[model samples]
Target: MGHDEPPQHQVVANDLRRRITNGEWEVGAKLPSRARLATEYRVGANVLQKAQERLIIEGLLEGRAGSGTYVAAPRERRRMVRARHREQRGGSPFRGDMAEIGRSGTWEAHSEARTPAPDGIALRLGIDTGELCVRTEYEFLADNQPAQLSVSWEPMSITGETPIVLPEMGPLAGLGVVERMRSIGMEVTTCVEVPRPSRASQAQANLLGIGLGDPVLVIERTYYTGEGRAVETADITVPDARWEVAYEFGIDA
Candidate 1:
């Protein structure tokens, strides 16, 4: 194949996508067997399977064990806004984003206190490896469907011995990072975020109800005090198939 030519599986996937878009297969319509599709496309079964898998990841198809692949019903991709204004409003930013789109938002969180920070977490929090910190893992849901995942780390040096040590246990439970920190006399002023594309792990796939290796968006976020101290850091994951991330900023007058 030429250097610029698309891969064989991708070419097959493209044609299949076109056929699906043209309604060659209605929603929930079962596709032909892989052996037949392979023969029809004049490609090996592996290549055809790869193409079908790609479409499956794109939400155009779905596989059923012991059954067959079928056209998946179209899903509405919702917008997830990443804006500084959301944080300023306090409470759960995820909840507010869901409410804006008329979806009931809820989340399950588990916080562990005195958990030793790993190397990466320590680096993000500007603390030493194995340093004590409060670790919280969250599964955010929109209308009770898992929509996002996050693992957050907060250095114990700042919150240790304080009422806010356990993120979801104290009086500030469910109050966002900014408000929680403010209640303890910490003035959080700066928020930094770095977004990168990644694939879903088995655990992530189970939680997000997506196939393993499906595309996802991971955002590295850290909150800083005015004095430039890193108070909390987190990794937020959003499944690409069901959500589109949008960044918004206000222009200075």
Candidate 2:
């Protein structure tokens, strides 16, 4: 066959896809390998490989590493179950600037800022009370509303040598104080998270656009070096009605 000719792999993939959709092969059923399909369809290995990839993308097949390709499980079709579905939400919800924050379906990256740490915050960065520290503040938003305010601190003595502390460093420069420190030779091996529910203070209430008596969510995180040295600490606040917290765990065997 000519190089310009329509490859036989595509033909085989289309046929298999049609059969699966037509209920000939149910979910979890195994499919033939590139070599076997090549023989059956009188096509080259390259063509068979191409066809398999197309089926995988179309959600008609699944490929597990070291395992052979198989018919894909039918996905649970979800409809507009609610008017305020996750996808309908906008930009970073935490900040008024971003319509939604966090991931559209799950989490989103809200507002992020890098500034000099204050005296009290310096202690959290493992620096002297008066030492220089970079403070990166993030407000996680959900569906374009404030979910949480996360403030991270890092000693300028550690990251000062890098441009990550610069004013116009741009977003995503130093995602979190821990990651930024790691980029400059400091490895954070431990993290401590503290969660609490309380009322938003006057300043916090202003930032969050909530009343003083309103219930709020607060989270504090501290990142530490390998030797139990605390490298950074964060204080976050979130309004209760605007944010939802989700956590999942998987144990390694």
Candidate 3:
């Protein structure tokens, strides 16, 4: 093989993908057995398996417990828009986003109060490591299907004595960051997000119902007050196969 040539498994995966795109396999069509495919491709069973697994992670195929792998029906990739207006609007922005696409959005959240901040989280929130913070984990759903996951942290020094201490269990429960902060006389004026691509961990895959190592988009989002104080920071995960993120910007006139 040439030094610049793709890996054998990757070449096989590409061919399989091309064939699928060309309608060689219909949705829900079971693939030939690994042994047969390996023989046809002139590769080992391991290599063929790897190739199929690659497509599985891309949402082109699914493996059943007892049955063999089959082509998956194409999933509708919803658009998730990130913009300042989303925060400015009251209520759950996630729900609004889903409503725009005719899907109902709901979330399950668990909050732990007085949790010690790890070094990374502490730095993000501009708090000292080991300091107390309220942590909330969220699993967002659209049409009762898992859509996004987020782990959020807020410094105790900022919200410990407030009614909105627990994000989802207070007078301001279910409100967006902007309104919640406003309730405490803090005006949130800035939102910053850094998005990066990642692979799903086992836990993430189980929750999102995707293959392990599937592609995902991780957004590090921080909400800040006019004084430049970060009140909340969250790591939001969106499965790449199920969602596409779009950012909207408004130019000052």
Candidate 4:
């Protein structure tokens, strides 16, 4: 198409995007069929399809591999980090920690264990054949919207005896495993933090009140206890709209 022709697909995408972003079509609203959109925009079906793809990339829409596309809802954001390190090591400063969030909002917890753990989770927990890690999940809400989805793993050796590491047990009970172990006389000497790009799953969408396949920020942290023994690992999913994280650096000079 010539510059004067206007990018037909882009024009179609922008109109739909504006509607979705402006909440004209609420989240989960089914978009018009390709033929319908093409007819309305006076463009070809292929052009309409390309327009839908653009909205999907912008996180304004969700498309099933085979199903249709739908308007995407907003998601709350979350920030997670080790409280002690942030406080003592002069890292990023935060207004709150897990405790503060837990106290201020509604949250739920689920825990269970199953043999033959799921793929990489099994290896990370160091469970040999026939063994499984005790997994606990927390869905935290802020101002009534799902703010964070977090999953923590503990070897059978630790959580098995308790069935759960309940919050009532104290901060460590609900804290990152490293701090918990330290409170129990096992010092946490090492940790690993990994973050990568990922899309929100249906479960996460349900919790965050967003349409399926929304974007999410994923953080994975592993903690080591006394003598460098791997103690626990946690996978945290944060919705970008409501969450943010910061890191601070100091100059020795």
Output the number of the lDDT-best candidate: 1
lDDT for predicted candidate 2 compared with the true structure:
0.60
> Which lDDT value does model 2 have at 121?
72
| Whole-model Cα lDDT of every candidate shown, in order | 0.92, 0.60, 0.91, 0.66
The candidate, 3 or 4, that scores higher on lDDT is 3
lDDT of 1 at 134: 90
Tell me the TM-score of each prediction against the true structure: 0.75, 0.49, 0.75, 0.57
Tens-digit lDDT track of model 1 for 59-143: 8998999999999999889899888789877798888888888999999999888899999989988899999999999999999
lDDT of 2 by residue, 126-234 (tens): 5666566665556554454344566666666655667655322544352444445566677877766667888878776655655556787676767788988886687
Query: Runs in model 4 with CA error above 4 Å?
Result: 1-84, 87-95, 98-106, 113-116, 162-172, 249-253
Clash pairs of candidate 4? 77-242, 77-243, 78-243
Query: Which stretches of model 1 miss by more than 4 angstroms?
Result: 1-72
Error of 4 at 49 (Å): 25
Per-residue lDDT tens digits for candidate 4, residues 99-210, read: 4455345567777765345667657756564466767788876655466788877776655555235432544444445455655565767667787768888788777655
For model 1, the local distance difference test gives 0.92
Report the candidate with higher lDDT, 2 versus 3.
3
Candidate 3 regions with alpha-carbon error over 4 angstroms? 1-72
Give the per-residue lDDT of model 3 (tens digit) for 1-253.
9999999899999999999999999999999999999999999999999999888867898898889999999988878988778876689888888887899999999999999999999998898999999999999999998999999999989899999999998788998777888999989898999999999999999888787898999999999998999999999999998999999999999
Q: Give lDDT: candidate 3, residue 47.
A: 96
- TM-score of candidate 4 on Cα atoms, chains taken together: 0.57
